[model samples]
Target: MLDFFIQPFFEFAFMKRALVACFALALGSAPIGVILMLRRMSLFGEAMSHAILPGAATGFLIAGFSLPAISIGGVIAGLVVVLAAGAATRATDQREDASVAAFYLIALALGVALISMRGSSVDVMHILFGSVLAVDEAALLLLGVVSSVSLALLAALYRPLLLDGFDPDFLRSLRGTGGGTLYHLIFLGLVVVNLVAAFQALGTLMAVGLMMLPAVTARFWARSLPGMMAVAALIAAVSGYAGLLLSFHANLPSGPAIVLACGAFYILSLFFGRVQGILLRLLPTRHLEA
Candidate 1:
């Protein structure tokens, strides 16, 4: 059994790519996810993930080429949509979430329509479900570049983002620093880029899951923000590797497999979290009888 698990580490190039991509993705998405969760903007992440598909297809159409170029184009598209949504909402009575959902649904529809014109099943699969095994060298390099840029941006903007997340009213009272808005835009861009980078390996739908689920699950066990981020990253990394192995051994789709692994952790965390475990429930029930 151990050899069956260990053999792919030595035998497959795709497996190697999958592992590396997942690790990079985990690091890139997890901390950002914690921020998103903190701000109650997990839906925004979902919107951004879905919003990139048309950009990706357009990039492919324009470049007649690489996934990285397509991904960059997708990220740009997503950011544009987000900016447009925010601007549109500023003048309307409609809430920000409503605007986000409308933009996401429209973008998703457009992307599907565009792809459906002449795309193959494989192309459709890649857009909807991702293929970690299909990651090329260029895509890998793009992932690394995206991850580095994201980390640098996070380091520079961490304090402001924290402030914005925890107390937007206080930030507003401090009056516009301009830097705060800039950091927010840059962070949004990072989210878009992360979605684009992971989309090919985890699909638009599941990529958002990867970004949010681990972070949410980590909250049950982590008492601090930094601890939550660390646990989220670890969960993402482990699930990525485990999903690849499961896919290889079970002939399953890698992205969904990874999501399933994340789901497993979420369920486990629900029942066995450090702060709210099954033991706590059992003990309380016994005390009720006493």
Candidate 2:
């Protein structure tokens, strides 16, 4: 039984690459996910993920599966949406949500159209879903570089970002010191880079799940921001491992398997987690009933 669990990863080099890539993603992307949840920016994050599709599709059209070009294109596309949305929010009387929604829809339509131009349904599916088990050295390097840069920037901007996200007035009050602008730029950059990295292994929809599900699940059990980020990262890493194992045993697609595993964690947390789980709330014998 132990061998069953251990042998697959040991016997297969691809499994090792997948594990490393997932762990790197968890370390980097999960923290960003935590902050997005705290800021209630999940919708924005999802929009940005969709925005990555057109850039990636264009890259595929140009380079035929070149990882770096696809990542750069995705980052560029996501950043453009972010900048445009931010500008429109400030320029117009419309709400930020509405502006972002419009931008993301446009981006998604462009992505689908670009994809439709070159690839068959199977090829398109590969771009949208990715092949996690087929991660090669170049992809690994790209993930590593993106993860490292993201973690560094997140660390540098942590305090200002927290203030900006949780209390923008306070963040703005400190704008004279320049940390506010730094936080805004770096935070946006981190989102773009993390999404690009995640999309490489998890694809567009599944990649967003990798960032979001763990954060939301961690919300059930964690009280402090730091604790929430830590739990989210752990959840992401564990989901990656379990998902890969399940895929190996059952012959499921890796991207969707990892995402589905994250969903399971979210469901379990919703019902049974110790903090604010539904099961706990429903227990009439508890002294904490509201």
Candidate 3:
């Protein structure tokens, strides 16, 4: 039992790196996931993940698989899509969700076309699906920086973000005070940065899974924002650990295995969570005297 759980990380350098990457992702992306869930922009994270692909592919086209080039390119592309979607929503009758959907669809197609133009199918698979066992030092460093930055920003803007999610009119009122727009932009930037970091470990397709599943599961267990974020991070950490182990023993893809572990947590939370699980709902509620 001890070897089954602990030997992989101790025996293999790749496993240790993969676990570190997953921990970085859990700490950074999971909290942001709670925020996204609060704002009801869950799908937006998924869209932004795809939005970064063209930039990554472009980086690959220009500089092979260099991390700096790919990360810079991806960050630029993701931010562009976010800014464009915001602009379109403000300028036209289309809603933000519609605008984001349109742009991500286009961006996804463009990214694939660009990758196919200069790279082989294997390269495409590697970019889209990722190889967590192959994570290098540069990628780990990037994840650490991204996670630290995201946590700092989230702490700085916690109140404003809560206001933005729950009371948009009030947050809008603070726009002239350098509150609304600034906070909004910072939040979106953080989203893109986290996604780009996640792309390095989980690939474009599975990146959002690490961000979202834990958050969604946390929702069933926690009612307060802080509690929810904490639960989400814990869930993400557990899923990452279990997923890596599953992948090692079963010869499975690391990214998908991690995501599946998150999904399993989601299912269990839905049925057994303390706050909102099906079992809880099915139980009789005791009335308290005032």
TM-score of each predicted structure versus truth:
0.93, 0.95, 0.97
Better of 2 and 3 by lDDT: 3
**lDDT (tens digit, per residue) of candidate 1 on 206-278:** 8987889899999888988889988999999998888888899899998999989988999999888876666
Question: For model 2, what is the C-alpha lDDT against the true structure?
Answer: 0.88
The 10 consecutive residues of candidate 1 with the worst lDDT sum are 281-290
Best by TM-score: 3
Give the alpha-carbon lDDT of every model. 0.84, 0.88, 0.94
Model 1: CA > 4 A from native: 173-177, 278-282, 285-290
RMSD value for candidate 1 = 2.7
Candidate 2: deviation at residue 22, Å? 0.7
Clash totals in order:
0, 0, 0
lDDT digits (tens) for residues 112-184 of candidate 2 = 8998898889878887788789899988998888889877887777888889887878877767546676677
Pairs of residues at least 3 apart in sequence or in different chains that clash in candidate 1: none
lDDT of 2 at 182: 68
Which regions in candidate 3 have their CA more than 4 angstroms from the true location?
A: 174-178, 288-290
lDDT of 1 at 178: 70
Model 3, C-alpha of 83: deviation from truth (Å):
1.1
